[model samples]
Target: MITLIRVDDRLIHGQCIVRVLADFKIEKIVIVDDFTASNPVLKNVFLLATPPQAKSVIFSVEETKPNLLQFIENNENVLLLMRSPTVALELFKSHPQLKMELNIGPISYRPDTIKVTSYTYLSTEEIEAVNEIAERRVRVYFNQTIDQKIIEWNEVKNLLRSG
Candidate 1:
């Protein structure tokens, strides 16, 4: 089963290996990002960054639909990682049966983005995407690491005054 479905900008990094891996007791990290999956170097980099405790695999958006259930069946503990809410929204919309929570983590500041949290910055499009995901009954929350308290999307939406 999917232990945690996380939207982390930096897919597999120091924070992930140091905190998330242990905190979540993740056994397999399924990265659902088209760009990173298509790029060999970036895929290898993320794979290398993944700690020995958890195995990491990359898959594109389309690939997820057919393979996600299979991935979950095979892995004891799964951490579904996506780079953005866009991808997570796609997965949530496509795979409705797979009930899971979405944890937004460390989305970097971008040109057309507003700061949602210190670690999370989102563009107008991303904000809407997340709202849509929450509307579908998927509980979404924001936090950099497990050590911090989670901020629910409801609070975030109220803060944004746009949800």
Candidate 2:
């Protein structure tokens, strides 16, 4: 079963490995990102970052689509991590059965993106994509680590609409 569906641009990093993993006792990490899945160097980097206590599998969005259900059903205490809202949105769009609430973490500042929170930023497209995901009945929240306060999706939605 999926313990958490996290969106963190840095993918698997210290914060994730130290705080989130131990907090959830996540036995498996299913990284769903195209860039990391295809590039051996990037994939190796993520693999190295992951703690040996937990196993991780990297898969591209397209590759993960068909196997998503299996990944969730077969694994116990799984944490699915993606680099962006778009990636999580894709999964929800293709596999609506992924009805679990999504946790939004660090989304590093980028050229076209606006800061929604200290660690969370979104471009116009990303904001809309997030809104659509919520409309699909999925809950999304911003939380950098297990200790931080979770900023709800509606709060983000309102912030985007106002500014």
Candidate 3:
């Protein structure tokens, strides 16, 4: 069972190791990213960042479809981390049975990307990807810290569509 599902540009960072995982008591972290999975150096960097007790596994988008079910079955309290909203949308497409609200975390600003909030940014493609996911009824919210108010995906989507 996936205890937490987060879409953060920085897959495994200080916030993730020190706060997110600790807050949720996540024992296993499954990072679904094509680039990180294929690159050894990046994969090791993430591994090093993870807490000693918390196991981290990086899988390409293609591999995740086949492996996600097994991973979820093995660990009841797993934190599912994706590099971007697009990746999370892809994962949801492949594994629709995994019903969990998506947490829109830090999506760093990039060229031509619209800043949804201080912590969230979206390129045209990223916005479209998120819109598709939201259309599927996957609740997306922007909440960096536990106390922050949840910003609904529909609100953001409408803003993007209108602007």
Q: Indicate which candidate wins on TM-score.
A: 2
- For each candidate, give its TM-score against the true structure: 0.95, 0.95, 0.93
Q: Quickly count the clashes in candidate 2.
A: 0
User: What is candidate 1's lDDT per residue for 1-163, written digit by digit as tens?
Assistant: 7888999888888888898889989999999999998999999898888888888889899987899887656647899999899999998887886756889999999899999988999999999999999999889999888779889998879879854
Q: List candidate 1 segments past 4 Å from native.
A: none
Candidate 1: what lDDT? 0.88
Scored by lDDT, model 3 comes in at 0.85
Model 2 weakest 10-residue run by lDDT: 67-76
Mind sharing the TM-score for model 1?
0.95
Clashes of each: 0, 0, 0
Give residue 25's error in model 1 in angstroms: 1.0
lDDT of 2 by residue, 1-163 (tens): 7888998998888899889999999999999999999999999998988898899999999998888888668757889899988888898888877746989998989899999989888888888889888998888888888678988988768757788
Candidate rank order under lDDT? 1, 2, 3
TM-score for predicted model 2 compared with the true structure: 0.95
Residue lDDT tens for model 3, 1-163 = 7888899989888778878888888899999999999999999999888888788988898888888888667755899999788888888888887765889889898888899987888898988888888888888888775766788887777777788
